[model samples]
Target: MESPERARLDAFFRHVTEQFPAGAPVTSLIVTHLLSERPAFLRAMSATSAVAAVLPKPRSIDQHTLEAVQSLYPVHDLSRELFADSTRALDYIEETAGGQDLVLADIGGYFAPSLSTLVEKFSGRVLGVVEDTENGHQRYAALDQLRCPVISVARSPLKDCEDHLVGRSIVFSADALVRARGDILTSRNACVLGFGKVGRAIAQTLRAHDLRVTVFDKDPVRRVQAHAHGFRTAATTTEAVRDAELVLCATGNLALRQDDFAALRNGAYLASVTSSEDELELTPLQDLYQRVPVGEQLTRYEITGHYFYVLADGGAVNFVHGAAVGTYIHLVQAEILAATAALSHGRFEPGLHSMPAADRQAIARIWLGHFER
Candidate 1:
């Protein structure tokens, strides 16, 4: 009904006054997600005004994916740290264990080949761990590591799965990415639509760039994080993008409904960093705008007096139009896993876990060394 830009502005003022009660500078906040896949979450941070950096995960990067990332940020692979104490059965092992030794074992739904190799290196030092579930015990039995001490990250899948998923493995360095998108920070407003890990990383990254960021999440818990960061939060998706000149949809959900984009500012760019362009659902708003053919696979639509450009059939604009920089950081992950395996030898124990901090530090050092060289 209203122009996208107008709607965005309304949402911005509402959130600024309502959600951001602390009066902290917009650039000081860094919002993050404790769950979900990485890439789709991080890019959404680009929409805000104070975003400084985007820290993403290895799974979010591929060789094809890396090119877009390289053009946007300096990428590196580093092991994440651990802050939880837990047990491991087969499932538990996969959830709580780390280093190369923990990835080799599997129980029903739990497994990580990455850790098994490292187990060999650690040999007797490594103790196999898993969940306490029957399935976990069955898996540990199949691997025949009953002789070793076992642990579990959770009592069952429903309880422990979240821990397993949230437990950090490999993360990408986003200092370069933040620097690359530096121009967007310090604007009046920005929007980040996903509240997962990558989304949080993007917000933090943008903040590092001296930008302020606004966050919206489907999960209510994530929305509360806005208060902690001293940034604004939108109660709904459309509200999140209301004030944003650059709207990035990281939710990997339908990006734009007719109602969402109808009133956006002219010359504003809708960016997507999700796995697919499914986020740009245009049907709801298309009815309001008159469309004229601009080019093959490209249609021009007018809203109010402004023109909005949707890139690559709503595919990832960063990937399609921007310079290609494939995921070299994944290669580093593989190397880390391999090196940990070699160090452990062939006698590793099974378990769930996070990556070793030492291993992560090693990767960071190596990357720094290479960059310095």
Candidate 2:
């Protein structure tokens, strides 16, 4: 925990503390995935703001992360985690706001579609939300009406840096899982669903490994873009998985469901690097398909007289080992911090907003100074 990134987060957050102060202590509900970098980030958040509660994303919490965040605030128990039952967590943390205007710094949109009642309960307004991931952004965007302004760093260029690197970490973990199964990816067929930043990186990395990579995206433009990038394009998810030995889902929107899983090649290695939605739809598989764990590497499933394997048991494979994607992730985390600064100051109206380009550039400049120096 004494690494340079801790110092870096402190400095980055200190810069934010100076650049934008709320004129009073800002009460915040932080929904975060507990990676190694999180404690430092949260500690810095506590140093600069009034924390209502610290909620961990289930499956991402580890013992070390738990120990680190334990002393910070009322870090919620994972058994009834925020994302699992957001309403209850919201109800519990509302008291901590002390009737002050509460702001949310969310990782996934845990409070989305569920915050109106709680916001109405607050004597002070629920100022706004700062969302970090595309999965969460989509959730908020889908809402026809929003309670407050939403500031998103998910589409920021700074976040794109994290997304691209996330793809590498995902491939690193998935390759390890495949090797754990006594196999390799070379000379094999791989299908990647979704051709956004992460999916594009995954396809490119797989090609570098000499895999025949095919990509499918519901957006016709992205499918064409994938084809232009020299990857084979599939017209449907079933078509994409029909012949590939390895299938990865980069879309957070449950790309592969029950019927889709029925089309996967026998013994295909399946993984997803997105949010906690089980993008490959593995829950019903337990009832419909026979599941057996293959040690710590992958879970084997039987469906349609064929077999398939899931890495990290249908969770994010990027963290199958750990969530560290080097010090670069702090850049994205810093942008999330900056979004909170906006929330504290009431910087937007009741609409969705991307991270300000000025804030994005300032964060990068600060990041370079913090790390390069």
Q: Which candidate has the top score in TM-score?
A: 2
The regions of model 1 sitting more than 4 angstroms off are 1-186, 282-300, 303-306, 311-313, 320-328, 331-373
Q: Residue-wise lDDT of candidate 1 within 76-118, one digit each (tens)?
A: 3322221012222223323323222222222221332223433
Residue pairs with colliding backbones in model 2 are 267-307
User: Predicted candidate 2: what Cα RMSD to the true structure?
Assistant: 2.1
Per-residue C-alpha lDDT of model 2 across residues 122-203, encoded as one tens digit per residue: 5566888889887888888988788788888777888777788888888889999889768888999999998988899899
User: Which runs of model 2 end up more than 4 angstroms from their true locations?
Assistant: 3-5, 78-90, 276-278
The per-model lDDT (C-alpha) reads 0.40, 0.79
